[model samples]
Target: MDKKKVSSWLESELKGYTLKSSQDDFVNFLIKQADKIDKEDHLLLKDLAIDWINSEQKDLTTWGMTIAVEYNIQEATPSIEKLLGKVKEGKLWTLYYLWYIDGFLKRIKEKKE
Candidate 1:
């Protein structure tokens, strides 16, 4: 994939900082940038959902959950749900296996809390 193009696309979609970096860096930048958005910019949250959760990079899925946890705590539940859907279907990323498991455990723990 064209990392630069993707980065630029993310920068535009995010609408705050101009993004100019490699795809990995851009992904991190987008995650960090999401923290800067005011709560009023709910659109940015949705953009983050599309960019991070639906990113082609499997690593971004975890990063998306991380950002969702940091920026929107309520989103953590839905993020785990999305990850669980992937795990159940056996399409979960090998690298993110533990992250997904931990998220599931976290959800269960929250329920018992």
Candidate 2:
């Protein structure tokens, strides 16, 4: 698939979008659709993913992590780590976020190999 086309579609799809499904369901839809696109679109998707992850909404942040993991956006590690640090101690949400970041880092390593 064309990177430009995919990026444009993502931009429009995510605009003013609200979470209406479970996090996993939403993430699955995004990753499955993104998988149809070429890996060369990583830069565009990475930007979108990072932006989403940085959003104030918890759902958006989760979606962002999913996109980052799916696309192997290693460049997002530092930001992910920073967010992890801010998670309140002993919160269950930290574990969930950690799982995503760990998977994302693993994919990055695999890509490097």
Best-fitting candidate, scored by lDDT: 2
Tell me how far the alpha carbon of residue 14 in candidate 2 is from the true structure, in angstroms, after superposition: 6.9
Clashing pairs in 1: none
Q: After superposition, how far is residue 101 of candidate 2 from its true place, in Å?
A: 6.3
Error of 1 at 109 (Å): 8.1
Query: TM-score of each candidate?
Result: 0.48, 0.56
Question: On a 0 to 100 scale, what is the lDDT of residue 73 in model 2?
Answer: 80
lDDT of 1: 0.56
What TM-score would you give candidate 2 relative to the actual structure?
A: 0.56
lDDT values for all models: 0.56, 0.63
| Local error of candidate 1 at residue 26 (angstroms) | 12
